[model samples]
Target: MLDTLSLYVAAPEILLLVMSCAIALIDLGVQTRLRNLTYGLTVATLVGVTWLCVEFALEGQTIYAFGGMVVSDPLGNWLKAFAAVAVLVTLVYGRPYAADRDMLRGGELFTLSLFSLLGMFVMISGSNFLVIYLGLELLTLSSYALVALRRDNANATEAAMKYFVLGAMASGFLLYGLSMLYGATGSLDLDQVFQAIASGRIRHEVLVFGLVFIVAGLAFKLGAVPFHMWVPDVYQGAPTAVTLLIGSAPELAAFAIAIRLLVEGMMPLAIDWQQMLIVLAVGSLLVGNLAAIAQTNLKRMLAYSTIAQMGFVILGLATGFVNGSTANAQYAYSASMFYVVTYVLTTLATFGVILLLAREGFESEEISDLSGLNQRSPLYAGIMAVCMFSLAGVPPLVGFYAKLTVLQALVASGQAFHIGLAVVAVMLSLIGAFYYLRVVKVMYFDAPLTATTVSAPADVRAVLTLNGALVLILGILPGGLMALCADAVLRTLAG
Candidate 1:
């Protein structure tokens, strides 16, 4: 049995599990018309979890609980806090859209989302490979159900099937890779695996071979090129509300996965994996940008854009520990951390605007559907423009700073390959800018296809406004967040 201190360290996860189950039961007893009660409880639960994460982060100690199965540390706590907030915002943006489509007749959305969030918390904190794999399954399963929540929609069901099949394959790849690592290193605990690899008793060829599968699994999760077949389909087929849920918060959890597995467990093999990441990054930037240029569907375009953004994250990861020296590891990892966090922030606002523009019986998913948004609602149009500009790496926005930090990290390594890769990333980003700028052009320059009033609830409006403002504010004064990321990565590495 776990003791009080161990339980206390894991209080957030414990509380979330309890709250999720309780909400499910309570929802069953509530009348269909009273769904808002369940929604309120879900939001409150997430708020409480966020507060718990904040408290833990403030303590700033690296403590292992459940005998090192889970860790209570700055990195996990920060990511957890952000995930909670992201889920809360996602629910806020999703509710109206769901209700409009009769998808909120039950509490399934709220419950499944909470469960998925719990999985993310576990993924962020897990110190064991099995624990991480378990969490990934929970998240992926919940997401599949959520995508297919509207069972009557053929496209949603089809997308869900694709997600399920691809997800299962990816999970299998990850598990097989872990088994290979266990065989090679004789341990499942990340720290032990790290020590074993450092000891170099294992066969080098076997380790590198396992790394191929591991990187392939991670690429699928991150939706990198050649492994990203499911992303655009799922994003386009699922309801916009579900797409928002899948896209924003999960990126934070995915970042945690990379940190735990690659940074903590396999830093010794950075050279091998770095080569794999470079190929993935370059392919992602090239495919994601060029493919997005031809997309007519807004959600599909953003999905491809997601692939591109993740390329930057991988670029940041590839720069850490250059030439077997970790002198620049802290800076490189911190830059990756910062990029993922800021990218999630920008994504939420972009999707929030999309959700706000949607109405009953209308999905508002087409790029041309956004014609003359400025004429209809300047507030939303401005918010969306900000998101687009930031995503395009335009100056005076958080995305620009995010890109700059990563590019700087790459260039600062003083390696010719790193510098050349940075240049390639810059050029790809410019190419990607064409699509983002096209959205802005449609919003401001084109004529409105529908003059429907873009009316969102006050709460949604308030949250969207804050989300947009944060992007710009962080751009101007990113030092604080940057420092937080650096500290988190540093403490994680030190521990």
Candidate 2:
């Protein structure tokens, strides 16, 4: 039997699980008014879990529980906080949209979201491949359902099917990689795998194959170049709320998974995977940014943009020195973490604006639809302009700092080849900027097609305001967040 103290140490997950069950019961009993109750419960549950995460962070003790399947550390603490904030923002931005569409009543959406958050916690805290895979599947399954939540829409169903099929294939790749690694090292725990590699007992062939499969799986989750085909369709088809959840939160969770698997589980094989990531990163950067130029649908463009942003994170990770090299690794890893935070904030702000602009009969998926937004509502147009500018990596915005950090890391590593890639990144960034700014141009310059009088709920407006303000605040006062990201990277690599 687990000790009481052990359970307390895992308090955040426990609290979430219990609350999920209570919410499920309430959902079943209050069928008529289930939407309000479920929304309240979802918010309350997230608040409680977030509080627990804060408590754990303050305690600042690394604790392993569930027979070492779960481990809580500073990195996980920070990531949990990020996940909580992402979920809270999505719920706020989505509530009115869902209610307006008459799609908010069922508890499945909130429950699934809660489960996904739980999976994120597990993924960040897992110390072994088995645990990581389990957490990943949990997150994946919930996302599939969330994508299909708009059951009446054929597009949503098709997207969910595609996501499910591809996700399963990706899982297979990951599981095969795990099996190979286990066979080679005779261990599932990351610490044991590292020890095996350090002892020189691991063979070159097994290590290479395992590394390839593992990185492939990670790339699939990140929607990186060769594995990114599903992203646009999924983003276009899923409900905007679902898109926000998957686009913002899952990317962060996937980044955490990559850090855990590569930095911790495969540190000894860094040289091999670093080369692999470099290729993947450059490929994704080329494809994602370039392809986005052709997309007129706003969500599809953001999906491609997400792919490009993931490439930046991968570049940061790839530049980090292998083995015991601390100086370069510290810079690279810290840059990657900072980029993740920057990307998350920008993405939330961008999607929140979309949610705010959508109305009863029309979803704001098209770039053309934003025409004359400035004339219709200058406040919203200003908020979206900030988001667009931030995403385009314009100066004095958080996105610019993110790009600067990654470039600095590349330069510090003396990888002059990255200079060429950096130039491509810059060029593609300008291409991306064209679309982003086009939205702004349409908002301010074009004529409104119809006087639809789109309006968002007060709650959504409030969230949008906060998200937009955060982007500028972080842009201007980035030192503190950058410091925290640096600390998180150092602590993770230390372990």
Candidate 3:
């Protein structure tokens, strides 16, 4: 039986679970016109929970709960805290957009967002394969419903179907891989599986086979090629509000699961999986950057850009081990964590701008829709420009520092191939800059299509201003955040 005290380690998840259920029930009593009540409650819940997670992260202790099925550590805690903030910001930025489209018919958005956030919390804390899968299913199922929230829209319905189909297939692949790992190791706990593999009793070939499928499933989840067929469709088809919800925070959860499965569970086979990641990384960079260059729709372009950004995350993972030495593990993992954290920050602001521009009848998803945005709202245009510049890895922005840390990790590996790969990554990033800059150009130089002024709620404006400022602030004085990531990664690695 689980001890009562151990449960404290997962108090945030427990509290969030109860709060989400409570909000769901309470939302029923909320009048149609009073959906803001539910939204307020949901945001409050997230804020309270975020505070709890922040305390845990700052504490920086690693604790296991429920017979080691879940963990409480700085990495998971930080990710959960940030995920809560991201979801809160998503709801804030999305509410007006959803209300404008009549998509806030009920408390579905709030309830579903909370549920999805619960799923992310679980994914971050899970240490067992079954726990991780359960979290993933919960998150993906909520996302599917959220995407199809506007059932009247054919595009949303179709996108949901595609997402469901691909997500199901990816889940199946992950399950099979887990099953194979279990059969080989006779354990479902990640640590035990690692020990089993390290013991040299399991067949190396069988482990490698399972790794192939595991990597594929992770690739699909991360939207890496060739498993990224659904990202563009879903990004473009879902309501802009839904896109904001899907695009931002869940990425942190994906990073958590990747750490759980790859770094913690499968480090014994790093050489094998690292090779697979390299291929996925290279392929995603090529496909994402190249395909993004051809996109006229901003949403689709961001989706491809997401793939390319994930490739950098994978590239960070690939550099963790070279010539069977784990010397660079801390730096590599910390760099990846930094990249993911900053990327999510940039994405929230980017989508916040998109959501702000969205109105009752206009989607504002086209690059041309942004033409002369500076003339209409220099604040939003500047915010969008900052996001684009950050994404493009320009100096004095978080994204450039993120890319620099990742590339530094690779080069620090001191392998010829790793250096070559960094060079190629730089080249591809240069190519990706074209599209990001084009958005800036459209905002700054082109003629305005509509003279209507850009407007957003004060709360949204405040949050977005803070979000954009953090991207630049983190870049300019990256030491604090970088140290935070390093501390978290080191704590996790120590465990």
TM-score of each: 0.99, 0.97, 0.99
Q: Which stretches of candidate 2 lie over 4 Å from their true place?
A: 31-34, 322-324
- Which stretches in model 3 have alpha-carbon errors above 4 Å? 32-34
Model 1, residue 130: what's the lDDT? 90
- Model 1, TM vs. native: 0.99
Candidate 3: residue 152 Cα off by (Å): 0.6
| Residue pairs of candidate 2 with colliding backbone atoms | none
Computed on alpha carbons, the lDDT of every model, listed in order, comes to: 0.93, 0.84, 0.93
- Candidate 1 per-residue lDDT, tens place, 1-495, comes to 878878998899999999999999999877765388899999999999999999999788999888888999999999999999999999999898888888887899999999999999999999999999988989999999999999899999999999999999998899899999989998889999999999988889999878888888999989998899999999999988899889988889988998899989999999999889999999999999999999999999999999999999999999898877998889999999999999999999999999988863588899998999999999999999999999999989999999999999999999999999999999999999999999999999999987776887889999999999999999999999999999999998999
TM-score result, candidate 3? 0.99
How many clashes in each candidate? 0, 0, 0
What local lDDT score does residue 454 receive in model 2, on the 0 to 100 scale? 61
Greater-TM-score candidate between 2 and 3: 3
Give the distance in Å from residue 60's predicted Cα in candidate 2 to where it truly belongs. 3.3
Per-model RMSD to reference: 0.9, 1.6, 0.9
